[model samples]
Target chain A: MNKKITKQIKELVIARLEIMPNNMKVSIGSYGAFSKDDLKRHVEDEDEIGKKVVEVQMAFLRAIKEGKLYPQE
Target chain B: MPKRMLVTLPDHDITTYYLRAWGKKAVKYAEDHSIEVTSLDRDKANRKNVESYLSNLPFGMVFLNGHGDENTVQGYNNEPIIIAGKNESKLKSTITYAISCSSAMNLGDASIKAGAICYVGYAQDFMFTLDESNSTHPLEDKLAGLFLEHTNIFMSAIAKGSSVSEAYDKAKGSLRESIMVAESSGNRTILSWLLWDYYAFVAKGDISSRL
Candidate 1:
């Protein structure tokens, strides 16, 4: 929420997206498909799509932290 | 009485292109099962055609594939076909499955309130990764398959006489399996998106409703 935290998350998301293969593209509903470099640019710009990607990555990290990805019986 | 199904596939852009290609599998499964299918494809996937079909036909299942938001599902060239407050009543008595983004949040609820037997869709953005090399041949893209195949499984289960809840469970189960596969293969990109989709999938109205 803070400016410092926001910048940190942006960097984290960009780093995660950077490892994606160049040939792959992500289609996010009406936002259309985005390539690896395109995603990094979005994150760097902190546009709507960039915020969305950051939200997705944050949600994923939270899920993992809560052990929701693989719940025990 | 014979069962009937209606599907809309709008192929005006790259995103819709993949949706149209994958949506064909559901249409084919319906045809193969002797279910009468009325597909509004390409330019025909408009509000007028969708209204005419729903108003006159007794289709038990409807599959809408295109771009969408919380209140509307677009058709050809992003034409609003089914708007929540305006035409959701047209879905009454039908089991509707929308493979678009975020329509499940509002339109799905509106349709159910308008008497739709059931509704299944994503509450948030329906995201997927595509292999650009297979852009010209979407069905052959294994990366995209990790996401779209679960949707196909849901529609196929419905066509096979599975109840709405049953079909939803089957799709979720398949997604979980795919997630495990992605993790085992150390594909974090695929795993993250798969998890996002799995969480986004939601169903409303009567879960026991079946075609």
Candidate 2:
């Protein structure tokens, strides 16, 4: 993973996760644990450590195109 | 008589805790509708016990909650309860609904081919957001509910005699509506994860089959 690309991806995913109400955490099975702090840690870590954050971010974008969210306003 | 609904609820970690909390509603709904509910909760949600229950009982539907992969549905402590090549046949003649990561990609298909009437699950990771402040009370976590309630609704629909396809449709519809609500509320952050859940959802084999 390119360090620069990893940094950019980490910032993007974390920003998205920050949309959750304060005191909430996101859990992505088989990818990362439940704590937002843990997710941030993963995103800031090396490519191998933070790959899931990038994967999930990409999946989220893909879902948007697939219209899985429906009525994408 | 209503058919039996066998549910595996494992509560060993944060992930399983949310599942267990959401499964409560499903269990209550099953019982309220006079559907026989057999639960393998906590430590009871192990491979040996699950196999024993299936072998000894007559269940029309099976609900699994745990960590899993494309080829397995696990139980307490991530023990494999139903594996693609091993005990997938035990699901023969039942409608199986798994609330686990990536099991639907392969295990769902394997179960159907091995004899299951139908299979419903996520082809990829099953994701959710929880309120850490309400972590002790997962059921009361509204953020988590935005994700888990849909899965519970699917199981509830099945227990209430809806066809497999109908339940699947109902769940997907619920997901869409939830996303809309989230969007209207300006909650864009979790929207993608919610959509990811919706996209990963899958119902295969015997779509018309019902419990």
Candidate 3:
């Protein structure tokens, strides 16, 4: 994807992550460590943030398969 | 003619926001339009309910609005899948419309294998009404006019007994952004919304029933 598209994807992933119910247990290990104030001091690229989104999404998928996210239906 | 529907909502309002919202009016509205809707919450959708519903000749339309997991679909009663004896068989072509968040993803393949005609739901997370002022996310909106708007145009075909796919396509076309499911890459959870449409896919059935 282009740089701009990747940036938008990051924003979208963040929005999806924020809505996951507590049952989904979405945690951004490193991203979580980033402080709001620190965000202003550092320049992060879309590709950098994009990695976290994939990790979180995979975590949720694995959680689902393992019966953590949404148990059997 | 009134079609019977086992309409279910969530036991808790948060996880099943779509159920909670649809219950607030969809049940009543469907009834007013002569749809024979049987409403239930998660607690009441027990074993008997699921078994009975599944065993019968398929209801023309199956409307589910609740929280779902890999092992069970939380209805007014909690119903888990029962493994029949090896030789026993199940249908693989029932049509379903799920307002549940992950019901489609968790149960999509299984439902199809078990004879579901078409399945619609959020592959990743929960679906929402247009709650524009939602405190939690910018995607939500106050969908006060949603049902009204949908019923007149989008849902008209379904109300007229058009097949599930027809109604679904009509509904989807009318609300592109609303039903799109964004496909996510196994990467960082960066701006993913633009990556996939929330209601992106429509798995169709073989040519048998017109609906």
Candidate 4:
């Protein structure tokens, strides 16, 4: 809900997404499509939908922070 | 009599695009094995056509490729084709597989309770990375293939008469191998989403049930 908090989360998600090979396209089923660059723009924009995308990204980030969302093995 | 199969593949955007293209693998397998396949693609994948086909056909396996949630699976234009607690019975007596988002969380359970033999899908958001360079050609997208191919393999396994448990295991195993391959290759981004998808993949109901 906080714009500053949302911006910080967006940057974090983009940082993670940036590690992929540029050829990759990340898809969240039917929500929307994103190339790496598209992902950056989608997550950082001030639009209502962009805020929701930030929220979703934050959830993934929170899971990662909690550990075990992605196993090392 | 050869068994019948119902396939719904709607082409709308990136996610649906991959599904529509990869679904042909299952369709081809069914045809080669003499399984009667009823395809509902594009606009034909709407609610009315889906309901009509299921109600009129004696299909044994149903594969749906679209977007969905815990309680519903959408078709062309995101129209709800199967809404939990409303028409899950349409899947009665059939083995169902949905390569959608989160329908397995609730719709899968509801359908089984409504009498489906088995339901296979992801419980949470189904994530996959596509190769934009392969936009005009989805099946060749290696990144997307890493995710979608497993589902196709599952469908093919079922078409070849493997039990639901066997097919599910085969798909999950493939996903696990892909994850390892991606990780070893220094690909950090996709591996996490793939692992998430692997964890989300689940099959409910008669595990021994075969199509």
Tell me the spans in candidate 3 whose CA falls farther than 4 Å from its real position. Answer: A1-73, B56-58, B69-72, B76-93, B129-156, B177-201, B206-211
Residues B1-211 of candidate 3 have per-residue lDDT tens digits of 1265555565443334434554546556556668776665556555456556656645545556555543234455334422222101222344555554345564765666666666655464332223324424311332322222332232355555666656656655544332122112232222122222223334444423433
Please list the residue runs of candidate 4 whose C-alpha ends up more than 4 Å from where it truly belongs after superposition.
A1-11, A45-73
Rank order (by DockQ, best first): 1, 2, 4, 3
Two-chain complex of model 3, DockQ on C-alpha atoms against the true structure: 0.07
Q: Rank the candidates by TM-score, best first.
A: 1, 2, 4, 3
Highest-DockQ candidate: 1
Q: Which digits, one per residue and each the tens of the lDDT, describe model 3 over residues A1-73?
A: 2334355544544555554332222212112223222221222344544453444444554554664431211
lDDT minimum window of 10 residues, candidate 3 chain B: B82-91
Supply candidate 4's per-residue lDDT for B36.
89
* Native-structure RMSD, model 3: 10.9
Collision pairs in model 4: A25-B130
Native-contact fraction for each model? Answer: 0.74, 0.72, 0.02, 0.62
| Docking verdict class for candidate 1 | medium
Q: Estimate each model's TM-score.
A: 0.96, 0.91, 0.53, 0.88
State which candidate, 1 or 3, has the greater DockQ.
Answer: 1
What local distance difference test score does each model get?
0.89, 0.82, 0.43, 0.82
Clashes of 4: 1
Q: How well is each residue in B30-85 modelled by candidate 1, as lDDT tens digits? A: 88878899999999999999999999988888899999999999999999999999
Report the C-alpha lDDT of model 2 over B98-192, residue by residue, as the tens digit: 99999999899999899898889999888888878888998888888889888888988987889989988888888888888778988886787
